[model samples]
Target: MSNIVKAKIIEKIQGFYEAVDDNNNKFTVKLRGTLKKTNDKLNCVIGDIVQIDVEDNVIIGIEKRNNLLLRPLISNVDYVAFVCSIKDPDFDIINLYKNLLWVDRENINTILILNKIDLVDDKELEDILKLLSQKLKHIKVIAISIKKNIGIDKLKEYIENKNIVLSGVSGVGKSILVNKLLDIEELEVGEISKKTKKGKNTTINTRYLEKNKIKIYDTPGYSAVAIPDYTDKKEIMTWFPEFKNYLSLCKFRDCLHIKEPSCIIKFKVSEGEIDKDRYEFYKTLVENKGI
Candidate 1:
């Protein structure tokens, strides 16, 4: 009889992959050639649930995935923690919208983190909360200062027992915060360059770490974000939760909300009902994609 065990792919280092079973046993595994017969795509990524045919403590097969992320190569993400800084690679609302759009396109839930709040004044932090509240109605934004150890407990409580993907622009102190959350000191923290005002790519690959029943996959900070393609430009509007109320009120059956006569979305923006910035962002996305 063969030793067949099931586990979740935690991380890959060098050539061997690490997996954690239900019993908390860690196994270092390698792929089996028989995997090629069933699935042509044998590549495995972090956060994948796999079955291992262990003979002498090695991986012999990889099971199919529930879902997969192309760039970072992560799968089965329950939540995405979008970590944004208040300063030092300053917070850009447009970029936040871009990140939200991509996350929504993937049909994944998000938790926006306003990190480094210790660097900002109360008023500045309050303003950020207000702005995020207005534009991101569906998403929840948590303000945290890993340096001061503020709001860490709240964030931890929210992520309890969930698989989270920590993502953001460089220089936002994501790794540092994650290390603090896990009570580990080894994860490298990237510094913001004085000349470029950008963060170094310290995290080269996806890393999986678990703490207090919560699992997190920290991905490399993305400088340039690409929104997912849509077959119909009108479909993009549905991703914005705030637009749903007015979508049915539009005069045309298929309204992209741009240059369409009696467009309820445009009217809402004009009347200060909808966020102008988000509306503008959507318009620009539609125009740039030419969908």
Candidate 2:
């Protein structure tokens, strides 16, 4: 008799995943391909609760998810932190905006972390902070230097009660942050290549630390990607918290908050009410999404 087995995906390897059954008994396994065909939308990502056949050995079907991320392709994730570094890789504000948009479109709770604060001078820090505050108004931002062990307590506090995923580009200290979160010795920190100045991928799988009631899913960093078409942001403008109050005030009801007559958003951007960097971010998004 095939049992309807429900399991929470913990870690995924090349073609196998380590899942926990209802009783917290763990098993290593793979999904049946029929599941992929049936759930047209299912891809069996990390953090997903799936119903397996458990007949012989296979994940037969993945139930619908409460939350999912496309770029890293993680599912049922409760929180996403867009970790940024103030120096070294230098802050790529544009990519940061795109990451924020990904979370916002998915309706997932998100936060921002400005890592490597110890590397920047006060002026640089203020400039970065001011830009983020003015532009990404709806999101929360925390500053830290994980290598120096600064602000990590606050980062841990923010993610205390959730199944969280840390995602961003390489060499921005995602894995370093993971080490801090897990407090593991000889903590698998990979060095960035001196020649390329890029991160040596340390974590190849989604690993977790189960204490403190916090399960942190450290995902492989992803290259910067434009927002996925896999979602419907019909009112894309409104998806941005900072854009909401001024959305209605846009000249065209269909206003993308871009290039319109009597556009309040443009006015704010010009008046310095909106951060110019964020305005440019919207422009880039509209261009990339071809909205």
Candidate 3:
């Protein structure tokens, strides 16, 4: 007799997937031939719920995903915590904005985690927080020092009972954060390169881990994140939550907000209602197609 069971794909190693069923039984399963052929719309990725034949150790079917991230290629994520460093690798505001836009396009919740707060002075941290507050008023921002144990408990509270993906540039202490959160040193922590002053890549692949009722996907750190292209350029503005109010007030119904006469978004930028840097970034994306 063959046993069919529901499971969640936790990780993919080699050609087999590590799936866990409701009873927390682990199985290394391969995709069924027919299921792989019909995987056009359904991708077998981490966080995917599937049906498996335990006896055959094959993934028989995949359920529809609630949401999918193309760049990281993950599915059904409740939140994306973008981790950044204040000192060693330095904070890249442009990259952070790019990440925010990417997740916003997917309609997923986001939280900005500024790690290594201990390295920066009070004034510098305040300034960065102020700037973030002005531009990302809709998003939640958390300043934490894993070394000093500051804001760790608060971070845990926010992500309690949720599935989150920790994403950011390399060397921002993502692996360290995971170890701290899970109270385990299973993940290796890499040191910053002396020559480039950047973090070395410690996590080469994405993995799913669960502890204390929290599920997290630790992804490989990235130095630079590229925003995916969209078919409709007009849709770009919708991702910026700050542009919501003035969008309707624009002169034309289909205003791209660039080189357009009587554009309220432009007028707001001039009036300081919108951050000039952010507006400029949007214009660059719209004109250059995210090149």
Candidate 4:
């Protein structure tokens, strides 16, 4: 008789998957030929729980995922740590907001990590924090410095025993932070380009690592984040939590908040109740049909 057991996919390379069972027994499994033939759009990815045939070392079935992210192509993510550096590559609020929109659409829990705080002075850091607080009050922000070993413990506490993915543009210190968290210098750290002041791509593949029972998926840094195609332009407003209260107060029942008469959202922007930059960014996303 053939035995089958449940396992979680930790990594995928070439055509094989590295999975670990409940007992921590590791197996290098391949997709069953029948499974491949049937499902044309196979969605198998890291963090997906699957059933494997022990005898054949083949993935037989994939369990239903709670959530999935397309960019890193991971399933069942509990938290996404969007890392941004204050210097080196420089902080780009627009990019951060764009990533947050993607995460909000997926209904995933997100934490904004401002890395490289050591490079910025106290007043500059305070002002940035203030700006973020006003614009992104719904999300939690943690400022960390890898060089000075600041806020690492606090960050670890927030993600303890949870499945997390470190995502950011290349050169934002995601790999370096991972090394610190895992207490090993395993992943390569890339340097920022002196001319462009942008991070060079370092992590090319997503890999899973465990530290004190904390599950982490370190993903490749993206220079440009791609929005999900499934995102409905009409529902873009729903992704912006700051617009929630004023949305219901709008004149039209289905107000897109653009050129609409007596729009509460627009009025709030004029009153300085909403961040103008954030509102403008929202308008851009909606006007472009979420492109």
- Root-mean-square deviation (CA) per prediction: 4.2, 4.1, 3.4, 3.8
Query: Where is model 2 poorest over a 10-residue stretch in terms of lDDT?
Result: 187-196
lDDT by residue for model 4 (14-67), tens: 888999876789999998876675544345788889999999899999999999
- Residues 106-173, candidate 1: write the lDDT tens digits: 66778988899999999999998998888887788999998898999999989988888988877787
Give the best candidate by TM-score. 3
The residue-by-residue lDDT of candidate 2 on 1-291, one tens digit each, is: 547678888877877888887576787878787656554434777788877767656887777889777767788877888777898888887677667777887788877888999998889899989877777777788999887788889878878878888776777877667766776553434333442244334566667656665677777666656665635434566546666677777667777766668889899888987778777767766666442
Against the reference, the lDDT scores of all candidates come to 0.79, 0.74, 0.83, 0.83
Clashes of each: 1, 0, 0, 0
The superposed Cα distance between candidate 2 and the true structure at residue 276, in angstroms, equals 3.2
Candidate 4 residue-pair clash tally: 0
Report how far residue 26 has shifted in candidate 2, in Å: 1.7
lDDT for model 1, on a 0 to 1 scale?
A: 0.79
Q: Candidate 3: misplaced stretches above 4 Å?
A: 37-42, 186-201, 245-249, 289-291
Candidate 1 matches the true fold with a TM-score of: 0.81
Model 4, runs deviating above 4 Å: 32-42, 186-201, 230-232, 245-249, 271-273, 289-291
Residue 254 in model 2: lDDT: 75
Tell me the deviation in Å of residue 74 in model 3: 0.6
Give the CA lDDT, 0 to 100, for residue 33 in model 1. 57
TM-score, cand. 4: 0.85
Name the candidate, 1 or 3, with the larger lDDT value. Answer: 3
